[model samples]
Target: MLQGWGIWALGGVQRIGRAHIFLAHVLLGLPGLLLRLRLLVREMYVVGVLSMLLIAISGLFVGMVLALQGHNVLSEFDAEQSLGVLVAASLVRELGPVVTALLFSGRAGSALTAEIGLMKATEQLSGMEMMAVDPIKRVVAPRFFAGLLSMPLLAALFSMVGVLGGYFVGVGLLGVDEGAFWAQMQAKIDFEEDIINGIIKSLVFGLIVTWIAVFEGYDAVPTAEGVSRATTRSVVYSAFAVLGSDFVLTALMLRGE
Candidate 1:
């Protein structure tokens, strides 16, 4: 049993390695991505704009919850006014990118996988290949680039809205001092250290999520059952990858600092 389990684990690792190489091939078509700017923009609209409402709603609620809980803690120490710093730091340094990536995995990532999987099931990708067309260049590259570009913007929007929600809860409802809230946040939240790192996290998440999504769709068995399975796997795998990578990145980014 132990040897069989070990063999299974090694096989899984090899499959993952192969998937990474496949993604690298897709990435090599970066110039083709630029050449297909129109398609890329369309995908951006689908992946970014269509997903904004949910991101906004989730961000607001998360911020509000953070403020409520943070105020409870800080008030005990007579530091209620530091709510701004707490909320802003939490959102910018961690929650913003992580939550946005999770949302993207559910909304845009699953959509990409399902769309491509269905196309594969319907023989569209094969038809393109039969015409001497590179499906990766024409079909995958634009969507990949769009996801890569959209994640940071979505994370920024999420952080901004979350901050606003925190403000509403902390200052409007809880009677925390408004000026102290904003001022403390502005004073402590370094743009380079906090904001830029958050953006970097979002970008890395975008690459991982999209790569998994498209690869699952492309390699899925060309059947209805296969397409459905691939779509589910894409979201699950993307979520795990985002969370796992976030831990490693946070450790690296904060090391010796």
Candidate 2:
């Protein structure tokens, strides 16, 4: 019993260590980030089409909530019509990328892990190696592109849907003046830079999530339990990486502005 417990602990530590090391390796390949591409359009379609529904639905609901909450709080200060600015700020800066990334991580990241793990288990990857095809370039490259492309599209979708939802609650539901809302938003916010920042963060998050999932699956052992463990780890890592990178990117973008 003691030996078994000791081995389990050591295995946990080693898995963690390897995961971190793998992340570091990917981080070091920043220069290759833009140029790495395979099945670019196909990947984009997968990322964009498959993930759009969730992003749209989530953004719609979140925007409504934001309008409601902002109305309640800002009405106290007689700044009720500033709802547009509030909605725009939350959607573009905080919620847009974060929510979309979380959704994508759940759907796309798990799919990537399972696909790669299955390939590994079936020795399809080995066959590719025997055929002198680089599995990383073939598999990872397309997926990385797909994740990256989908992120910006999803971020834009989130921003648009969130804004519309906020408008619905603020103008239609709350009976606030629509013009006043947009006016305040235009005057108070830097829409250009903030949108760019949000999109950039989303792209980074997508890349990180897919990379972690693919890496784990690629290295997964040929066992059902091992594949399951990798999938779980992919999700946990996806969430952590998305959130952590969001904070870092937000700070850096805001600091320069």
lDDT to native, each model? 0.93, 0.82
lDDT of 2 at 49: 87
Could you tell me the lDDT of residue 31 within candidate 2?
49
Measured by TM-score, how close is model 1 to the native structure? Answer: 0.96
Per-residue lDDT tens digits for candidate 1, residues 30-88, read 88777768888998998899999999999999999999999999999999989999999
The 10-residue segment of model 2 with minimum total lDDT is 29-38
The alpha-carbon deviation from the true structure for residue 84 of candidate 2, after best TM-score superposition, in angstroms, is 0.6
TM-score of 2: 0.85
60: Cα error in model 2, Å: 0.5
- Residue 95 lDDT (model 2): 92
lDDT per residue as tens, model 2, 129-213: 8998767666666676677667878888998999999999999999889899999988876756887778788878877877788
Q: TM-score: which candidate is best?
A: 1
Q: Which residue pairs does candidate 2 place in steric collision?
A: none
